[model samples]
Target: MAGIQDGMTVMVGGFLGTGTPEILIDALVEKGVKHLTVIANDGGLPASVTGTTDRGVAKLLSAGMIDHIIASHVGMNPIIGKGMNDGTLKCTLVPQGSLAEKIRAAGAGLGGVLTPTGVGTIIADGKETLTIEGKEYLLELPLHADYALCRASICDKFGNFSCYKATKNFNHVMAMAADTVILGAEKVVEIGEVDVDTFTTAGVYVNYIVGGEQPWQI
Candidate 1:
């Protein structure tokens, strides 16, 4: 089976609240994969920020494994800056909402999506510009990855997934666009344990399942 490897691009699912997938991140670490390009919302906790065991992508960053980062904000953690300055990390910052839409467009097989988020700013520098009616829009290419790391509230043996409350962030869209998808879950049950009405992510997108991390460990 295709597993983690060096020099691969990975899409990670998480947002401030319900989106973090601690288990999947840990699994990647355990796999000892390196030279990665990670696309995510933010850097996970850092040793300087929380002072406990490292959680989220922080563990990967601390390991000096990642080669590039495509994220909305890396400044939330101090170690990220040091890594960037010291040439251990390379990054490209995209707006949060725009980042989500880009992943969705990629998953849906679209070439790109049009948006006005970064117009008239540094983000518009080298991108194509379009005028629809009287408003201007910037075309952002869709983002897909070699692998997508996601987390869910519960999943069945068949791979269908659902997120709880606010944590549902990018997990849903990233699942669709990646070449391979792996999920971290709080609970796993029979295929029918979760009702069809609440099913947000179907089984076809997921490939593996790992348990979740301790409560708010990251």
Candidate 2:
């Protein structure tokens, strides 16, 4: 929380709107954090379609708080298209599977990942390529963030977390790939309340935890 400065790169954990940490994002918007570079799966759904004022990264995008984004898709959010066309925001789109592997490589402390997902396409334009056994693979660099904001279905006092259903999509990986990890949990329980067997993210990776709001509120 203390080190969130201007132009910081942030990784937000979510698939569409399901797993985004809405509470932390709201706080960031309230603080007027600007010129951010966000990394996520998709741009986010619009308020009109979701029947809400803001959801996922759209909150920051709508507030003009973000300057650039590296995501796999943006078609669902008109704001992204408008910004890109108007030159207000910059976007770099990646193959979805490659995106996930890049984040995972960062978290795992690997130099990079090799995949065929982007071979022979524009995605490989400026990237390195390697041939192994007569097959080609594009080298995608790891994607790390200065901070990561994630949502958890449940979090304990010590910050151990478990997500419900599809909410776990990227939260667990993003938690390990950032310098600072913050979580917003729907339910905050005592340290021992969350079973270790069920925990997807350990407290050692988390820096802070905040109470989360319901889906409607987000």
Q: List per-prediction Cα lDDT, in the order shown.
A: 0.82, 0.89
lDDT of 2 by residue, 1-218 (tens): 56788999999999888899888888898888889999999877778768866688988899998999999999999999999999999999999899888999999999999998989999999899999999999999999999999999888889889899888888998998999999989988987765677677888999998985565453
- Cα lDDT tens digits, model 1, 1-218, are 14778999998887642367777777678778889998888887676667676767787888877899888988767777887888878988999988998999999999999998999999988999999998999999999999998888888888888888887888999999899998888877787765766667988988887765445744
- For model 1 the TM-score comes to 0.93
TM-score, per-candidate, Cα-based: 0.93, 0.96
Model 2: lDDT of residue 61: 92
What local lDDT does model 2 show for residue 147?
Answer: 97
Report the error of model 2 at residue 190, Å.
1.4
- State the weakest 10-residue window (summed lDDT) of model 1: 209-218
Model 2: how large is the Cα RMSD against the reference?
1.4
